[model samples]
Target chain A: MKNLFLIGLCIATASASSMLAQDFSAGSTAKSWNLYPEKKAFFKAKVVDPLCTLTGSCPDNCSSGKRQLALLRLSDNVMVLPLKNSQAAFTGAANELQPFCGKDVEVDGLLIEDPELFARNLYQLQKIRIIGDTKWTKANRWTKDWRAANPDAKGKGAWFRRDPRVKAAIAKDGYTGLGLETDEAFIKEWFE
Target chain B: MFKTSILSCATAALAAFAGPLFASENGERITITGEAIDTWCYYSGVMGGPDAVVGAAHHTCALWCSAGGIPVGLLADDGTVYMVLKIEDDDHSNGGDTQMTIASHVITADGMLYKRDGINYLVVSKIIADLGITNLNHEDYGPVPSFAIPAPKP
Candidate 1:
């Protein structure tokens, strides 16, 4: 009787853990999913600085400061991510982010239904969850001219190409790894 | 285990079908609801009319690492499934254009929704083009409701 009772307790504890645990199965209809490439292919990218202008970098209260925004493009796709949680200023920053476009990466993210705030801070939560990560190779070729894309912007755009060493650094630091997390278990399963 | 980071939180954004929405005679935002079968979740919705779509198109459905182009099952607030689609381009673009890429907020068959982040949101288009007020697409448009906005103008 004692042994049976111990086994029952173990079974119950295991079931409860599974219930709370997030699953990353390939076909599971869970809340999150990652980038599982249909066919394994090497995805290349250009390592450009995430550009943002700091308002009053060395001045008054933090509320009086502002950070523009960041925008990038992967091939023909245009991407706009706000530097801070401010929807009203998203468009203006998006307009400036045009020049800092980067390449498309194969990763996964959790999307939210609405934007929310936590702990009373400017860094608010978005409807989408930032999940998964992918390896990004260096771009050996980039010929697009930003001067033509943004005639009014003053400075020249990011260097179309970068030194080989910088590419390696970005691959190592810029992105989180694609595996070892439950959110990305799908990626490993994709290969199997 | 997928350790959700303390800083890396989840949130919801807007994503509606890539089309025009206009006001009905009753003057309310045309609420669209449906089921997204064969998706992570099932229940779906679309609020806001033409103007909302104009703003949320393509730009609204940008995923962190999504490769674009996914099936969609549109719906309204009342739980009505619209259509089963393989492509949902939230970005502003033509339907049949091959160069365009699309994505959809997938849904399941039993009425469960694939919650993006931790919230559910709707994407609304502009009235003039959505309701075909001025015959933008040439399709026989229907009478859409409009509570979100008063008389559709501009």
Candidate 2:
């Protein structure tokens, strides 16, 4: 019974690890080739790109969101898997790599040498450890749970504090930049 | 039920993710005020930034390969591969030399700015091929010379 519980715990932990957004370890390389992990090597490199062309029908690609982005091939079968939590930054991702003429890079990933791509057009990735000295801490978000923390200053102070940029617009246009700070108005224009 | 402002919202977003490292410690938009011929650096040697960059289309989808290797079934031709780019207006400073948007892609290979639709959709995707922003001129983000170019179809 205890062993079963331990197995369950392990599966849950592994699932959570995949769910969590992690940065790759830096100043590392594919030092050795073992089909499995010997130990977690701290891995880090300036995040580059994958090896796929995105095709879409609309201006913003397909509205459907994806977790597994693309494949990256280094040598014949060398590749890496990089993932993101949100879909916003990828608009920049497409343009950053336009100049390489389809070749001119050295990728740093858990080097899986010559792994054949699967039917899903992906390599079967082996587990590798990533080392990140500076882990990104989650940013604070304003939420109902948050307002519960600070009720008093939630009214006028919160409104003004959020919109310091409003002062710039007001100065330029001779009118108050009101409604809300951030995308309160803009989101509606694009979305709602 | 809720109010969301795109400017202020994106402002916080810039501060949250893009802060302290990219523009300034404050995450403010830093327009370089000068040109560096910069675009986003695609780590992969092929297919430009679209295939390699995580989070461009879908953060997770772009990251699918971050764990390592999904075959991007792209075979290029023997032409100079070009990445899509957007231009920024010069009014902003301390700026990133990212790809200029079509509206702001004034300096073409022929040195003509694109102004169409009253809302410019003008930067050419294959500037290195089209405009010749090659390494001779590009100090920062130049074009790659050799690549996995496929044979042009007969």
Candidate 3:
């Protein structure tokens, strides 16, 4: 009887620890699906930078920050914005996607019903693997032309300073709606 | 052996039910004032009206749109949009209706804010309806409201 009791206690302790660990671990259902009824599924799609996909205009500096890439469903023109999980756990999915911009990849994640500004689906990326490649333009391809034609806004939302959408947004909201209003000193505290 | 089997089963059960408890890492406690809007319509720019923030004017449509899995958003006065998860708890299974009932109405809610993957979610603890006349656009658009933007002053 004593042996059995010990075993039961051991089991209870083990289960409790695992339950606690599972809650904090990456891909925790609680973290991904507790609020929204997100469904997990596998998807194969080509990754494209939002600006290039939307405006057919790729900026010269196609850094990760400037180029937010999302998956474009092949069958439908649906966009999937991948969300990052723990850096140590799920890895930085955004960084993983950067290299594969314009390449086809397979992603497994929880599909949120939430849509972006244009009804694009929001996908919480869990696992991603490149399936194939597509036409990838070299970075800074338009640097010379874009610079020559436009006045420099000096890295203050520089990528989109001249965009018509940005101009219209400024006209309506008084600001670019980007981080242009953020102080350079404040930005340095975090960056430098 | 029997004890080991029981332990395994208990552990499995605990893991299965432990999801909600760990889902959100509640950030700072905050009080935010905003209008509840259907994320789909607001983001898609097809709000079918001038304001995407649904109130009685767009309540019925908000209900239908949100019922289909679209997230409900709280567009705050500061221009910050928070994705509101549950009202208080998960008790109200018919969340679509509950959300639509408060659509476009200005609300001041106290909650724990959470940030996951660059997105901000507000795990609302308490919500207070601010039913001031200006706080609401009470023009109930009926069960199936038509989208009309009273033609721009042409």
Candidate 4:
């Protein structure tokens, strides 16, 4: 009887692990492969361009033109979804991570699971504090200056076209502008 | 009175489990009409803010984003955003970019709607593109490259 009880406990534990959202161990390239419970979770990582982070290629500063959100990448390279604030309703807090894009930051949020959301690493971002290291400060200043220069620019492509960094890329690399590789292409190459 | 209460409770439970595979609360299949917007931009309002026009004016940009693995959303006329999930296919023929080509174009989608944590999600079963709507100039960001697009068949 005791042995049967132990077996049952083991089975329960195994099932629980399957349901819990977990990181794809070190060196693994998977991003948010499953749903997470709606609870608090903390992570420290850099906010990278989702285009470059997920697909391994992009124009200078994510000029992909899609309204893609910034994604958080842990030190070990685990990707996390940074939630977005909506425009129609104009919530003051939606897409709060925009300013911190491409910078290292600490994030704590309720892990709300929604598979449809990119990265499947949904977090109801309770707090974000920038790391403010040398690398972060430089990138943060550039982003601020870029925004100041193009106050009316809203889309990635628009900003990309107007960006001096992107112009340098274009002058250096021509119309290809840092070469494009998208997530759809990655999935097709690997999974499909 | 006790018997009536038991019957009502039983019926409610039955309705929930016996409903269609992805039925909304009403146990009905729903069809929503709206502009297909990239989920990231709709929520973040990052590019052009939240009120940015998402139809033909932004079609190319939207397509580029949607094809890049960003989740596509159906921003309904009623101001509701339904995060769309593609029903998986074995051959992977109906990829995301195919859908984004119609970005910024108005279309009707038939699907089962689900509301979770105040967010709307739809398991889109069929998409009916309204080419007449696509042909019309709704708003403008700039010149949409004259890439030839075939109209949806009548």
Candidate 5:
């Protein structure tokens, strides 16, 4: 009987650990943001494309990497727009939540609210976990995906400075993006 | 450059003062006129200086960034950048029809303003006016990033 009790205790412990396990670590911004303390919330939600939900402009897949995605909270049936991620700087959480489109996931984040007139609530997704799964995914995929896509653009002070697209555009349109004549005039007036 | 420096200093001061005032339980209501800008390129300065990245010159790029899930910001006439949380009934800040429609257009927005971490967040309840691509900088800066307009297929 003692052995049976020990076995049950072991199962309970394992289950609790599994239930609490989070796969991803939160970034500094997750805790440092002003709203983190008062607005943070963890709940179950389904990832969905906002365009399709708002208007019937449904696409084949949410993983298209272009459209914005939102979370439909299971508890209140309210759709939350995740404008930012856990990463520093201004980045969105679309790519982070894209893979889980249409699937229910556990989201750990903040629902920023302004209680005055005409104020709308916005979300900052810090961590996400697929429903029924033990691991949580951090909402920090923008930089990683950007780095992977621009493998050749290395040694960047800022990703923009080294980006091939930006370079090519500048080359084609001059530094000011104006025609050559305007650029020459501006340079002569400012520098010369 | 001198103007930009002064604006930057002024913006910093305003933000420092405004942050606490707006952070109250109830957000402050205000009406502001500004251009709907692409927050990514505007903040990153990837394409060009602040002056070059607005109006018709940067309209195409603004659309691209907004479509790619970068939240749209309203660059007020006073040089303040208000990160738009939501516009009217549209829930998402980026890639929404409303955002796409107003990309680079100068609009008078009536909304509730919330400031957090020195960043201003505006929830636009109504667009008082859309002054349609008023900044005509394209004449001086052609497409800010020429690549924003796709090259025609051969």
Candidate 6:
């Protein structure tokens, strides 16, 4: 019975540690832009709507994900703006941090700072987990959210090409998007 | 005279490109004239080529993209792009009222420029002059993506 109790305690402790630990899968951008060796920051912060924090333009539930979100570091009360995520290309970290609005989370990311130039630093969030939660979540939700929002934009060579909005816009605005007159002139000069 | 202007522009471009090599720990203070652009579409090319994604043509789309949290970049006249960290008193890079108001407008900005990972990041302390949609590329490209301006409801 004593042996069984010890085994249970060990299992529980391991499970608890696993829950608290961070699992980070670095995105392509993070791997490329790790310029400052000493800038990687891990800390607890509350996810906030930067507009509200800076402008006092508080909205309900961070404007229901309409506005960009940020982290107000609990330790220093400084606002850290996570411009990019761990993703490839030029994706932003809005959707990834949106879910945790107003809640405290453990952020594992790079803090890009230039004290002489920028008074506020920028964050590239690689991974995050709720302060008391078990599993860490990678900051790569932009593409996933884009796909979910655009269901019929399928069979993509490039996502923009297959997008219905792009097709409609091109059809209405024409290739140059200048106006029908310019489009006609362009077509006449180039294609015809 | 034209040759001298071309040579001067080339020299400026070279200097901007080589900025990071000589950057101090305090960063370099410079004044740059550029269009405030939506960085995502400019780099992603989802809308169109770099040329097609600026000025009056891409103005509407730039506003939409900025509102959606894409960081705004200042595409300088010398063809250098600076990812704006903050502009004036606005804290957020994108989606700030200041950024939204200047979307696609060419303005002379005085700021401190920071270079990292071959990217130019600017924190604009003041905007000297707002040149209001000077590119006029829409006369050539329409709205690079066209869909930026929604069709009027039937």
lDDT of 5 by residue, A1-192 (tens): 654455455555544543332322243224535541125567788998755553444667773765667787675455666776777544677888888889999887765544321123356788888989987788888767777977997993655556565555445544444445764564454333
True contacts kept of each: 0.00, 0.00, 0.01, 0.01, 0.06, 0.08
Instruction: Pick the winner on DockQ between candidates 4 and 6.
Output: 6
The DockQ figures for the candidates are: 0.01, 0.02, 0.04, 0.03, 0.05, 0.06
Provide TM-scores for the models: 0.21, 0.19, 0.36, 0.37, 0.49, 0.50
Tell me which of candidates 1 and 3 scores higher on TM-score: 3
Candidate of highest TM-score: 6
- Runs in model 6 deviating more than 4 A are A1-38, A114-120, A164-192, B1-34, B39-68, B73-103, B107-154
List the TM values for chain B, per candidate: 0.20, 0.17, 0.61, 0.61, 0.81, 0.80
Better of 1 and 6 by DockQ: 6
Which candidate would rank higher by lDDT, 2 or 3? 3
Q: How much is the lDDT of residue A118 in candidate 5?
A: 19
From the highest DockQ down, the ranking of the candidates is: 6, 5, 3, 4, 2, 1
lDDT of 2 by residue, A1-192 (tens): 654455455555544543343434355442332323122123322222321122121222211121122233332221233211112221212122222223333333332211111111111212221233233311122122224533553455332232333233333321111123322332233232
For model 4, how does the per-residue alpha-carbon lDDT over A1-192 read when each residue is reduced to its tens digit?
654455455555544543456642333222231223344555676766543433344445434222244444564354454443211121212235546667778665445544433224544454566765423221112234346755865666444344453344324422211122432232233233
Q: Highest DockQ, which number?
A: 6
Tens digit per residue, CA lDDT, model 1, A112-132: 122111101011111221123
Deviation from native of the Cα of residue A104 in model 1, angstroms: 15
Score chain A of each prediction against the true chain A by TM-score and list the results: 0.18, 0.25, 0.43, 0.41, 0.67, 0.65
For B25-144, candidate 1 gives per-residue lDDT tens digits of 121224343322211122111222222221112111211101111112243334333322112322211111111112222222222121111222222232111210111111121111
Per-residue lDDT, model 2, residue A29, is 40
lDDT of 6 by residue, B1-154 (tens): 5565455545544454343333343558899999988765565444656788887677656755664467788888767778776677665653556786677778899987765433566768899999766787866876557554444454
A125-165 in candidate 6: lDDT tens per residue? Answer: 88888999978899987767767877987894644445564
TM-score of 3: 0.36
lDDT tens readout by residue for model 3, B1-154: 7766676667655664454333344467889988776554454333344353455445434543343224567877655677665567532212234554455557888987765333556667788765411332423332123421111232
What is the lDDT for B108 in model 3?
A: 86
Q: Candidate 2's C-alpha lDDT?
A: 0.24
The TM-score that candidate 6 achieves is 0.50
